[model samples]
Target: MRLLAAVDLGEGLESVVESARFLQEGLSIPAELLHVVPTPYFEALGRRFPHLRPGLEEALSQVEKEVQKTLADTGLRARVLRGFPAQVVAGEALKSRLVLLGQRGTGTLEALARGGLARYLLHRGEVPVLLLPRALKAVRRIAVGLDDSPASLSAFRVAEAWGRALGAEVFGLHLVSGQGGCCFPTYLDPETLGLADVLARAKAHLESLLKATGVVEVSKGDEELDLLRLAKAREADLLVLGSKAKSTWRHRLGRMVEVLSSQSSMPLLVVPEATVW
Candidate 1:
């Protein structure tokens, strides 16, 4: 398996390296560090003043050197690809099993642009994308969103790999319907099913799903807020969510993951049902 990292030579460089180490420490996988070079905007000056070209070359060389130094101690290979950074990341993500990118992205334009490069890459890339925040290390605590769906089960499987790799503990949270006294007539409604029965069913499903792993710690709550609260309260480094690339429904993936992708304070790791790892 290939673990591709979108390495930035700036403040978040450590987070990029941290991700590479996280994947490599457990699985002896092939890892690649990608740096995208944006085309110069001042192209007209290059023709008018030929001397300007050499300075651009020098800047690129300096950037390459900086990236090399940042990854000197870490066993990561750096590859500089030339193109628009967002497009490059999206395109190369196809060849990778997992893409590790720093939050908020890089470059003045992308930084200044609305939503930033990270947001664009998340929407564009089909592969599982991990958005690493600054100053985070190994996945010590992981919280997974749970449901009876196969996609959620697949997410739990990926979480097992992460948990074993990091030597961490795993917890799960399932949202019960009709929380906050607003009762909808859906099948998931706790008011309709009775809280006790709903919880019992949830526990039974979790026991059956995680029987082999011996990870029986899970809770069924009333809302997604409960999962978010657990994530923050436990100081979790990663929040794993299940997303299906193509659903039978009219829309692609629903609004939940999309909202979390934009608003989450903690790092979000998405595992699509079709993803192998």
Candidate 2:
């Protein structure tokens, strides 16, 4: 598979480079390096202010040179392109299997609050986008957070495929929130279950799900924190999670998802839970 990684020369540029290297070595996919120059206004500002422009240009040139040097050093081929970052990267994504980017950028709080290019791409881009965490060292295994939803199953399949391809361990994780709100718990109440009995039954259900998948390394926890902790404990290379069910555009931008998205530190492969594909 071919992958396109956008290197913005922002704060996480080095991490992006390292991730590209890892993807090349692990997935055996050809990675193309893309650099997006902002629109003409920003470009013109840098051009008109000769002294100011030189330093910025020089720094970016250095990054480009370093990227090329690293690719050559590792015997990987790379290409550079200039345009609006999100648009260019999204366009490139249409021609490739996956896209990669850093978790955040080097822009001001206002710009970042507005959402970085990576966030934009995650919401709108067609292909799967991998947002590299800031602290990744090496990817040894992949973990899929599974639920009873079709989207979760899709993510699990993708994680399994990637794990097999990379010769990495595949882990199935199911988080059972003790709060009695979701559908699963409601269904269990009909069977005359107490809280403790409900958790036991949930564990058994998760076990059945894992048995169906034939993945031996299955883990279940009661809290999101516990799931993340288990992933870290296992030194997982990737974490796959399902997005919420479909809603209207306004509801989609609600607070819960925003908070959850802000908290994730690993590369979150979010698959729409209601997606048919």
Candidate 3:
């Protein structure tokens, strides 16, 4: 499987590389480093000032050198291309099993473009996207959002595999939304299901779905806040959530995904519904 790490050479560059190194070493997978240059803007400038064309070439050459140096010791192949960052990364992501990127974009303009590149990939990209914050140094624990739905179960499966390969502990948090407090509720309010019964049933479902043993916490609260709280309380290095490309009436995993994509403070791994591993 291919692991693609897209870097912008910004403040988050180091964090992206750090995560890439960890994944490469821990998972023993081949990785690639890709840097996308906004060549169109440079070309526009070149047209406005024809004499500055040589300097633009020099700048691009320097960028290539920097990219190569970044990949020198990591055993990662480097590719410098020119295009819109989101489109290029999304297109290449189709061939990759997972794509790593920084949550914030490169420069002020990119950053100001709210939820710019990462959101595009999350909604349109075919592969799983892993977003790392600048402060992330390593991943030692992974917390997964769990529910009885297959989408959440699939996320746990991916997280479980990564935890085993990386030698990290995995935990599950099942938020019993106020809409329904029971995991196996037949109605909005199941009169027969008690809180203990809900927790037990949810834990059992998680165990069976994951086919693994770990701490699975079932609580009644908001999904997004409770998930973040669980991760923070556990001191988790990564937060894993499963998201669907399209919205459905019965499930709204994508909503939680979009909220956390921009708000998560730690590394976030989003497994797309179509992802196999």
lDDT of 3 by residue, 1-277 (tens): 6789988766777777777777877888877888887788888899999999999989988977776776665566778888888889888898888899876643546545646777778776378889886544566888987776666777888888998988888889877664443333332234667667766776776777777665787776655766788778878888998887654644444666866777777788988776778
Model 2 lDDT vs. the true structure? Answer: 0.61
Report clash pairs, candidate 1. Answer: none
Leading candidate by lDDT: 3
- Candidate 2 structure quality by residue, lDDT tens digits, 1-277: 5777776556777787777777776777877766665545646778888667877777667756775665555344566655576777778777877777676533457336535665665566256667665734565688876666555566676777777667878777655454553223334663476556765665566557556634433333454556667777778878876554344365342222344355556776665444322
TM-score against truth, every candidate: 0.76, 0.72, 0.82
Q: List the global CA lDDT of all models.
A: 0.67, 0.61, 0.75
lDDT for 8 in candidate 2 is: 59
Backbone clashes in model 2, listed as residue pairs: none
Model 2 lowest lDDT segment of ten? 251-260
Candidate 2: list runs displaced more than 4 Å: 42-75, 104-114, 135-137, 182-187, 203-226, 244-260, 272-277
